[model samples]
Target chain A: MSEPVVATDMRKLAATQLFALIGFTVREARNKWTLLALFTLTTLFLFALATLVSIDVVEGSIASARLFGTIPLEIGNTTIPVSDAVTVIQVAIVSLLTTFGLVLALFVTGNIVPLTLQTGWVDLLASQPLGRTVLIIGRALGAVAVVAVTFAYLFGGSWSVLTWKTGFGNAGFLVAGMIILFTFLCCYSGMVLVGVLTRNSPISIIAGVGTWFMGLILYPLHTYAEWTTAFDPGWKRSLASGIAETLYWVLPKSLELTENATRATKGDALAWTPFLASMPFAIVCIALACWWFSRQDY
Target chain B: MNVIETRDLAKTFGGALGSKVEALRGVDLQVGAGEAFGLLGPNGAGKTTLVKILLGLVGASDGDATLLGHRAGTPISRLEVGYMPERRHYPGFLTAGQVLDLFGKLLGMDATLRRQRIDLVLEEVEMSSWRNQKVGGFSKGMQQRLALAQALLPDPRVLFLDEPTEGIDPLGRVSIRGILRRNLEQGKTLFVNSHMLGEVELLCDRVAILVKGKIRREGPLSSLRAPNPEYRLTIAGSDEDAARAALAAAGQEAESVPAPPGLTVWRLEVGDRSELNNVLDATRSAGLEIEEVQRVRASLEEVFVQTINEADDDKAGAGGPGGVQTSAKGATEVSVATREVDNV
Candidate 1:
C-alpha cells in the first residue's frame, strides 16, 4: 500500500508539471488577439456552412436543386444532385480544415518555444526540480494540445452540422482532424527546434512554414519527375528525382498525411506510410530540440 | 554540513573562432546549512554565472558542484533549492495566483499544501492584494515581489536569489531584505548574488568576492573587512605631533589626516589588539586627548573595488589577457605568457 501510494504521488507530480505547462500554453493562446480572432472566424465559418447545408432541396423530373430560400445552387442550368452537393460541401470543409486550420494553428503557436526560452522565464524554470526533458516535452505537448482543441472545435462542429443538416455524416471524417493535428505536430516540432536554437519567434515561424511548404512540394515533385517522360532518363533526371525523394522522405509528409485523411473519409483504405513516417520525423525533431535545450545554458 | 558546494567550477562560452569568454574560472565555494552567504562582484564579474551553475541552470565546463549532496544539474539537487533570477518575467496572461500555482506545481507540491503556501507566500511578499491581477500589468517591483513569493513556495532549504532588490523602490527593497532576513532566521541557507553591497554587508554571515572569475577574497564579513590588524584614533585637538610621538613610543605606524575643525584623525597600523590598547594608553599618557577610537576596516564596496583593481594590475603585470588557469581542486594559479587568454 505504501509503495502504491508513492507511485501515485509520483504520477501526480508528473501530471502537475505537464498540466501547468498546458495551462500556460492555453493562457498564452487566449491572450493573443489574433488567435482569438481566428477562433471566432472558424466558429462563424462553421455556422455559415451549417446554414447553407440547411437550405431545402427541390426535386423535379429532370433536375434537382439546392435552394437557399429563393436562390438555387446550379452549375450551367443543371441543378446539382443532393449527394453531389453534400460531397462538394464535405470537400470544401476538408480543404478548409487542412489548409486554414494548419496555417492558423502554426501562426498562432509558433512562438511557444521561443517564449519559453525568454531569459527570465527560462532561468527560473531551469532551476526547478523538473527534468529538462520533461520541460521541453511538456511545452511541446502543450502546443500540440492547444492545436488539437482548436482543430477539434472547428472540424467537429462542421462535421456535426453537416451530419445534422444532410443526414450523411461519416464518423471517419473526424479522423481528418486528427491527421491535421498530427501534421501540425510534425511541423511544430521543427518550429520548436528553431525556437529553442534561436529563441526568436519570427525565425521559428519562418522555419516551420518553410519546412511545411518544402514537404508539400517535394513529394509531388518527386512523384511527377519519377513518372514523367519529359526528361530522358539520365544523371540530371536521376539527380533531380533523387534530391526530391530524399527531401520528401527526410522532411515531414504534410501533403501525403492530409491526402491519406481525405482517402480515409472516402471509404478508401488509408495508406499508413505517411502517418507512420511522420511520427518518427516529429519524434526526432522533438528529441533534437530537447537535446539542444538540455545541453545549452539558459 | 554544506548545503551548497562548488569546486573549481569553470564555465567558458564561445571559443569557437578566435575569442573565448571565460565566465567562471576555479570558483570554489561552500555555503553551510542555514548560513546567509553573499556573493559580490562587479558587472560581468561572473556572480550570476556562479549562481547559475549552482542552481543547475548552466552547465559547468570543468570541476564539480553539488546542492544538498546531489551533483549540480541533476533534478534531485534542485529539489530543495529555490532560485529567483535577476530578471523575472512570468507569462503575461497569468494572474499572480496562477503564477504561484504554476511554480508550486512544478515544485510538485500537492494542491491543498500549494494553496495554503501560496496564500502565505503572497502575504509574506505583500502581494495578496494583486493576487488576482495579471502579471503583465504588474510593475517591476511587483514582479520582483511575486518572484520572491514563488521562490519561497517550496520552503526550500537553500535559496539562490540574484539581484532580489534590483529595480525596486527603497521601501520594496527594505521589505525584500526583511523577508530574506526572516528566511535566514528560519535556518534556510541563502546564496545571494547582488550588486547591492550595503544589503550584503547587513545580511550575510560570510561573503566571497569574485574578480575576473576568481575568488579574490572570501571569509566572514569581519575577516574580509580587516584581514590585518588596524585601528583609527580621533584626537580632540590638532596635536598631530603628540599623537605621532605617542604612536612611535608604542612602536606603531600611524598616518595623520584632517578631521573636523580642531580635531585630527590618526590611522594606526597595529600588530594586534594588545598593540591597539597600548597605543591608546600611550596617547593618554602623552597628554593627547583621544576623542574616539575605532577599528579600521574596509567596507564591502571598498574591498570589492580594491580586489578588482589588484586583479587588473596583476593581469597587466603578467602581460596575459585577464584569464587565470585553474585546477579541478579549485586552486587557481595565474599563468603568465605561457597560455594566451584569448584562446581560453
Candidate 2:
C-alpha cells in the first residue's frame, strides 16, 4: 500500500484508539492520586511563587528605592520593572516549570513506557483492534492536554493579577501562554517518542534528563566559543557549543518559548524573533515525534 | 466449510543473535461451523500467538488464515470474534460494570443492548454483587470471570478463549463451560487454548495436539483411542482348539492361554465392540462354556503423551534428539454442545 494510505489508515486507527486510553488514563490518575496530588501541590507552589514574584514581592524593595534615586535597570531603553527584571531569568522558576513538565511527560509516557519494571498496559490493549499509532497519539495528546491545563491555570492566575493591577487586557498573553505550554508539550512528546521508539521507559527518561542536564552545563559554551579563537578553550567551547546548538535545535526548547512569550507580551524589539525561531524547533520536534511513534511496536 | 481455517500459518520471532523462536510453524487447523474445536497445547506452544494473530495482535510471519470465512485480522472478522485471553488485564480502576460497558461499546453494541448484556453477563458470571467493584481488588478467579463476561459482551459468532478456566473455581468452570456449551449449541464456533487435558477430553468433539509450534496430531478425540481389537474371553472347555477354529472361521483371531486348570483365556481380536458379543454367542452355540468378556479403553492422557512422544521420535529419526516441552498449563478445553451422551 502507498505511504499516504497507510498514514490515513493509521490516523483512523488512532481515532478509534482513544476511547480505552481515556478510560485507562482516568484509572491511572485515580490509582496514582497520591503521587498526582503531590505533583499538583508542587506545581501550585510554583504558580504561587510566580504570582508572588510577578507582583514585585522580592523586587518591591528596589521599587521603593525610587525614593533615593532613579531605577538603574533597563533593557534596550525599555523601562523594565524591578520585579520583571529580577524574575526574568529566575532559574528557580524555570526549574519548577520544567519539573512539572517532566511529571506531565512521565505520566502520559507511562502508558507506552510503563514506569514500573513490570508488564505494562500494552498487553491489555494489544489484542484489541486498537492501532499502535493511535495509542501513541492518544498518550501524546493526553500529556499535552494535562500540560495545557496547567499552563492555562498558571497564566490565567497571572493574567488575573495583571488585569487587576496593570490592566493589560490583551489576549496575546493567552496565546503566548499556549505557545509556552505547547513548547513543553512538543519537548515532552519528543521525549515520549524516544520512549515509544525504544519501548523502554527508564532509558527514555534518562536520555531526556541527561540531555536537559547537558543543555544547562553547555548554555554558555556558544558565547565562550564566539569570544575566543585560542587553541584549547576555544576548541572545547566550539565543540560544546556545537553539541548544545544541535540539542537546542533537536530538543523542545520551552525556555526559548517562555523567553519569546515574555518578550512578546512586553513588546520588546526581539519579541517576534525568538517565537519565530522556536517555530522551526517545535515543528521539527513534533514531526519527529509523530514519525518515531508511528513506527513503535506497541 | 469451517468457521476458522488455517493453512500453513507460521510465525517466527527474533533475528540472528536472538534465537529464532518459532511461535507457530505450519499450524493447519479447522473448526467447523457449530463445532467446538479445542486447540490443546501446553504453555509456550504458540497457542497465544496463534490467537493473537487471529485477533490481529501480532502479525503472522507467513501463511494465510480465515476466521468466520473472512481473512484473519480484518476488522469485520475481528468484529465477529469474542476473545478471552489467558492473562486477563483490565484497567484496575474501572468497576467491573464499567469495564464491560467500555468493551461492549468498542464491539459496537448499542447502548440499550450494552446495558442489558452487561447486567446479564454480570449475573451469569455470578459477579453481580461485585459489578460495581473495581477490578483491581478482584481475586484472580474473579478477574477471570470478568474477562469472560467482557468476551461474551459482543455476542460473537466465534469465540477464542485462552486458558479461560485458569483461576476459576470448579463450580465457576462448570458454569462457564455451560455458558460456552449453550453458545456452541446455538451454532457458535469456539477456539480454545488451555492446558486442562481432562476438560478437553470431556468437552471437545475434536482436538489438535501442538508441539514446538507445529500441530503433530489432529483428529476427532475418538481417533486417538486405540482401535479395540483385542478382547478377553474366559471359556471352560477342553475344546479350546474348537473355539479357536470357530473364531477363525468367523474371521476372528484368537490366542489361547491358560487362565487356570479348568478354564482357558482367549484373546479374541474383533473388528468392533458389537462383534465381541457375537463371537461369545458363536462360542456358546458351538458348545463351549463362555465365562467372562470385557473391553479396555485408553485414557486421553495416555494417548496424548504417546501421540506427542511418537511425533518427537519421528522428528528425532529425521534429524537430532530434541523434543519440545511446553509447560503443563495453557492447554485448552471446550464444553460439549449438549449432553449428547447420557453416560459420563
Which model scores highest in lDDT? 1
Scored against the true structure, residue B297 in model 2 reaches a CA lDDT of 51
DockQ of 1: 0.45
Root-mean-square deviation of Cα positions for candidate 2 versus the true structure, in angstroms: 7.2
Q: Model 2, B155-261: lDDT tens per residue?
A: 66777888778767888789888878877776777887866777776567888877667787888887765434456777786666887877776667778766877
Model 1 chain A scores worst on lDDT over the 10 consecutive residues at A1-10
Best by TM-score: 1
TM accuracy, model 1: 0.89
Per-residue lDDT, model 1, residue B133, is: 100
Clashing pairs in 1: none
TM-score of A-chain in each prediction? 0.86, 0.61
- Residue A115 accuracy (lDDT) in model 2: 30
Model 2, position B101: C-alpha lDDT score: 73
Model 1 misplaced stretches (Cα beyond 4 Å): A1-12, A53-84, A226-237, B15-18, B234-243, B259-265, B284-291, B316-344
Q: What are the lDDT figures for the candidates, one per model?
A: 0.78, 0.62
Compared with the true structure, what per-residue lDDT tens digits does model 2 show for residues A150-265?
55666566556545533334455555666556556555655665665666766766655554444344445433555434436757867755666776555545555555555545
